[model samples]
Target chain A: MNLAAHLVMLPVLLPLVAAALMLPLGERRRPLKVMLNLASTLALVAVAVALAMRAGTGAVDVYRLGDWPAPFAIVLVADRLAALMLLATSVLAFCSLLFSLARWHRVGVHFHPLFQFLLMGLNGAFLTGDLFNLFVFFEVLLVASYGLALHGSGSRRVQAGMHYIAVNLAASLLFLLGVSLIYGVAGTLNMADLALRIPAIAPADRPLLEAGAALLGTAFLTKAAAWPLGFWLEDTYAAASAPVAALFAIMSKLGVYAIARVWLLLFGVAAGPSAGLGADWLLAAGIATLVFGMLGVLAAQEMARLAANSVLVSSGLLIAMIAVGNAEVIGAAFYYLVVSTFALGAFFLLVELADRGRSAAADILAVTREAFGEDEDEADDGEVGVAIPATMALLGLAFLACALLLAGLPPLAGFIGKFMLLDALFAALTPAAGLAPAVAWLLLALLLLSSFATLIAMSRAGLNRFWAPLEPRVPRVRIIEMVPVALLLAACAVLTVAAGPALDYAGAAARALIAPQDYVEGVLPPPATPEVAP
Target chain B: MELVLTIAIGVLTGSGIWLLLRPRTFQVIIGLSLLSYAVNLFIFAMGRLAVDVAPVLEDGTGNSDPLPQALVLTAIVIGFATTALFLVVLLANRGFSGTDHVDGREPPP
Candidate 1:
């Protein structure tokens, strides 16, 4: 009943209420709606930070709705992992909303409300202790994203939006089927309770449970943008407006977060036969996704598509590391997740600005030149003497920072994260439940190869866009739009400077995730004595 | 009852997936609807089929499980909303692309 207990619900409630309030205000009061949206997001950040600090002290905060007791009632648990994800979500939401203030919010009807609802769903998914609740939250977020994806309503946007909707609707059905299957087998939908019951489940029902879990994993992987399941990602993201794409960069991570949480908590070392049920398959899928994403990055001509591919690369790395099932490696993966997501968001915003400086024919011309083996320097010889404007220079620097981050280059958080991740992967070389030495070496090489590929592709695109422009036109960059990019990049810089503490926090979260006894106990307390009516 | 339910789910899913792969937006939307219906029925059957029994417990011996019913209700509501949204988007897509093909263009004759 105290304030800290209620804080667990605020992240979900604040957005829901704000979105409801904004819906009734109508389109005429755009400025007021923007202010309300900004205020709500900023407040969410504050709450998330506070929860992170509280969770850092190694406490699990649980809030039961309507004063209902544990397993039967829906509960929200804010442990280190949930709090960390909430913090990341709020930071990205705040930045994306700020960027939208430039122009995107006015692009279509109900933009502000949809944005808030998306946040609500994301926070709910991160915090919910019940599997069924997770499905509902997934639906909420997907619906909002469907709206936001088609906000500008160009032909390309509408086409991509239709595909996105169809794919996700199917995924939602799979989610329901999986949840029901698990419920039928385990007779409970609460995750913590299921974790307790899974170990003692009848052997005859094991296959059914595993099948259900596989279905569930498929649903999450689709949303997470795993290879073959995520062909819709690039088109949908590339076609979306800048702010929406920036916001979506975090949405992909939501799947990884769920996988790490559920897989580690429910199928960990405690489950006798199911301890490592699908680990190898997860590892295989992750590697394939990583390779697919590398090719995508190299082949992409548009800047937005390049950013989208980088998201896939990051997701692949995280998914593979999570499959390693070592607490330490998972910790480093969390660091990588946070840094890469921020960088991707900033990069998406930067893409719009960078592409704005070029003429409409620039992309086609570049392709034609490449196809014909024409010298690009000779084509722009007439405009060679034009000086780069200050705005262009700033964008170039931010672009350079993003390139470094995406490719895992040094002197930024990306390098530190990748280094820590590699170090942890090598350090965790136990024969059982850890990476083999050869596999570790292979992962190292693969990581390096992917990073190298990203570097090459990014430099190629950078040169084609920034240096080989047919004309040096300065985009009318708004201060509001520019600051969000700056802020997100600054966050990456801060992460680099504070790598020691950040990794420690991530390590704690990973440990808490691997051994969720506190989480389970926190949610399902010893039955409280019933009050006698006097 | 169980056999009938299982066959229905199987047929619906098979047809839904087939329609899902069709070329037109309208077919895809209908496919999605059929898939959702199959999933809803599957979830409802998870509680185990019972005949003429109260969902809520009166004496608790012959009562059907209430939780799956509740879950199915929520799923149906969400599925309805999404199907409506998909139809709207389908119309908009047709209007914008001037074609009903999922790819926004017709195939060669």
Candidate 2:
């Protein structure tokens, strides 16, 4: 076996081993835990980058556990789509861990190990080429997230964590049912093999397969936080500690990635009538989700809640794009995914530090003043301490950058991502068989409306927090905390500056996703000649 | 035998769903446990229930598919772990909020 074939497993293995190593170390060994986690995260990032470069060349790498063959054994495949997700996740993880190191890690026991375990689960979910393993990984990540969500042990965190746990547990049950149905119908848990077997399935079994697929879609949508199924998301994410919330921004996208990969690969244009069967419902639910999120963003009383709503909007757009089933939209959606997730992740990290020094009364005061009209009393509370202009200015600037990214304003990657998506929508209309012009126009309008809503909400919140400046005690944000936020925002800046190559990579990934022939081949190669000469 | 399994799964899932809809956190956790049991059994039945047969292939006639059994085992273990974790979180939540209401408040008592 090629040594590089082993690289396919590194993303999952690196985090798992590091987390295991950290488990036995006492909480007193904080420095060692941080160092190990940082190293593990950084190494995973390097591996993901390498994998992305390799996948860009259109090669799919597959690793078989214990040298087992694909169909009957565990397989992990790294295609362009998987590699891209891994890269994005590790980048977010590295920043989140760095930010947590500032003070949040000390508030809770086992924060570091749980974070690493979450990464392991994420990487495993991204890489595993089988359905059963996907369930295992989903549970792994959820369990880790449950621990992290309750890290601070506040009423709100625990309450929200309980809701998050309960909802996901239900989804897990649905996941099992879905998996069992698929297995019963196809007798295979390997995704690629199932894809091959699905079309040949007896017509009588088609309904069961469809039911299973629909149930599976429900599970993913619940995680993706689509409306009706996503009531748990905004509050749960908002209540999490800053770094944990930041880490969770990417967690939501795991569902987006899974849906796109599985729906396209198994029930793609290749599946005949089922080819695009779910597209319309996806579009409907996505739009509803977007509208619901916009309302939440507008109504959110706190910055954390607003950020959580924006995460919903981001996922809604990606889900809508996936439902479009066009390579063009998928490409733009992939780009959008990277930019928005980073922006939202950064915003989540920034929320705690930004809110720390401000009086909760002042926050309400800021809101009411805006509602009633800016008046002299808006600056009611006189300062008792010297305000740090430089730190306040730095946070304001960071907030502005995140706002621009979230609201799809000019010159940032968010704008570029939205532009690409709009461009794709319009470009699709040029072709006769593309999404109908009216539907395209409607989607275009909806996207614009969501962005506009985000801008309005963010503008009010940003001004209220930074500009109002009344009753402000300068938040004693640490250099460690500030550094991670800056790094995350800088990463977004890099995405904006590097949009050309980024778009190309996303395009390649989208194309590969739309046409997963190579992926299927990599996962399920013709079984090697019966080695034992049976 | 298959009909019996079907009815068992139906009862478990129906009861689970009913419990899941309740506003109490403890009930929801129990709902999840019951639902997982239903799912585990469903996964087991997917391989086609068999009597007096080995899971592993021993002769030309073959045996029940063991893959579903294996999958169900893993699922059961995971379900156990999550239930324990959920119970911990619920305890913490009740400690903080002073109620087991799913919304974290008492019901006008």
TM-score of each: 0.94, 0.94
In candidate 2, which residue pairs clash? none
Q: After superposition, how far is residue A177 of candidate 2 from its true place, in Å?
A: 0.5
**Tens-digit lDDT track of model 2 for A54-160:** 98899999888988778778999999889999999999999988887765676668999999999999999999999999999999999999999877666777888
Give me the runs in candidate 2 sitting further than 4 Å from their true place.
A360-389, A526-534
Write the residue-wise lDDT of candidate 1 on A73-158 in tens digits.
99999999899899999998899898877655665789999999999999999999999999999999999999999886667778
Model 1 residue A364 CA deviation in Å:
15
Q: Which run of 10 residues does model 2 chain A get worst, by summed lDDT?
A: A377-386
Interface quality of candidate 1 as DockQ? 0.91
Best by lDDT: 1
Question: In candidate 1, residue A457 scores what lDDT?
Answer: 96
lDDT of each: 0.88, 0.87
True contacts kept of 1: 0.98
Q: Model 1, stretches more than 4 Å misplaced?
A: A361-389, A430-433, A526-534
Worst 10 residues of 1 chain A by lDDT: A525-534
